[model samples]
Target: MSKHIVPLEYETGLAELRGDCARMAPHWVVPAKAAASPVAASLIHGVTVPPASARLIDAMSDYGD
Candidate 1:
């Protein structure tokens, strides 16, 4: 199966991280349930304005259970 990533920023971040910033960060690593929740999308929660170090990995993709 092919994997599609919705890198945690506006469209701009997709371009940024895909480039040399391979190790860049998303605003947050969301739980699959929360991330996929239609209600949550409307809310658009964040982990504060800016994290000290925003680098995080979500290799697991969807965090189920």
Candidate 2:
């Protein structure tokens, strides 16, 4: 998947978390009916943000230094 370019806040957090952030993953939950509902279909959904990358991690590490 392509890397997401999130806001600096997320980038900073991800950088601070470092390796621990590896466990993070995109997640979503919706009832079967909701998933199939016209409203749900019409509504904009899904994670558009990209995950953090090595560059982001390194940059975050330098935050307080």
Candidate 3:
């Protein structure tokens, strides 16, 4: 006689979650901010923000309290 082992439904769900975690693994590592110094210098000099950058800042501002 031969026996078969079957995984439960939750096991499949867990496997899918594992795959998602793997795909997002790189996002877990913060990338270096290479342009930070230039941005900071511009801010210190009171340089005007471009319209696109200003819009991005406005959009991102709504993401938090």
Candidate 4:
């Protein structure tokens, strides 16, 4: 059986998603510093924007040899 390979973009996007989730997870109340930054606000939007075909690749790639 051939090994399945996830694309680099999906992996990178997933990493970003994980990081964003971790960053947000610790805060029930957003910190004043974090909440006030435009950069931080922009990153929040990225949490919802996984790479295209990310879910499909994730599901299918589990069968790798």
Q: Pick by TM-score: which candidate is best?
A: 3
Model 4, position 45: C-alpha lDDT score: 57
What does the lDDT come to for candidate 2?
0.57
Which prediction has more favorable lDDT, 1 or 3? 3
Worst 10 residues of 2 by lDDT: 22-31
Encode model 4's per-residue lDDT on 1-65: one tens digit a residue.
99999766554577898899899887867657645535555556535537766666666857421
- RMSD to the hidden true structure, all candidates: 20.7, 22.0, 11.8, 19.5
lDDT of 2 by residue, 14-43 (tens): 566764655553333444764543566557
TM-score of each: 0.16, 0.16, 0.26, 0.24
Q: Estimate the TM-score for candidate 2.
A: 0.16
Query: Of the candidates shown, which would achieve the greatest lDDT relative to the real structure?
Result: 3
Tens-digit per-residue lDDT, 1-65, candidate 1: 99999767556666765764556446447566645535656587765633333323233345422
Ranking by lDDT: 3, 4, 2, 1
Relative to the true structure, how large is the alpha-carbon lDDT of every model? 0.53, 0.57, 0.75, 0.67
Better of 2 and 4 by TM-score: 4
Displacement of the residue 55 alpha carbon in candidate 3, Å: 55
Q: Report clashes for each candidate as comma-separated counts.
A: 0, 1, 0, 0
Per-residue lDDT value at 36 in model 3: 45
2 or 3, which is superior by TM-score?
3
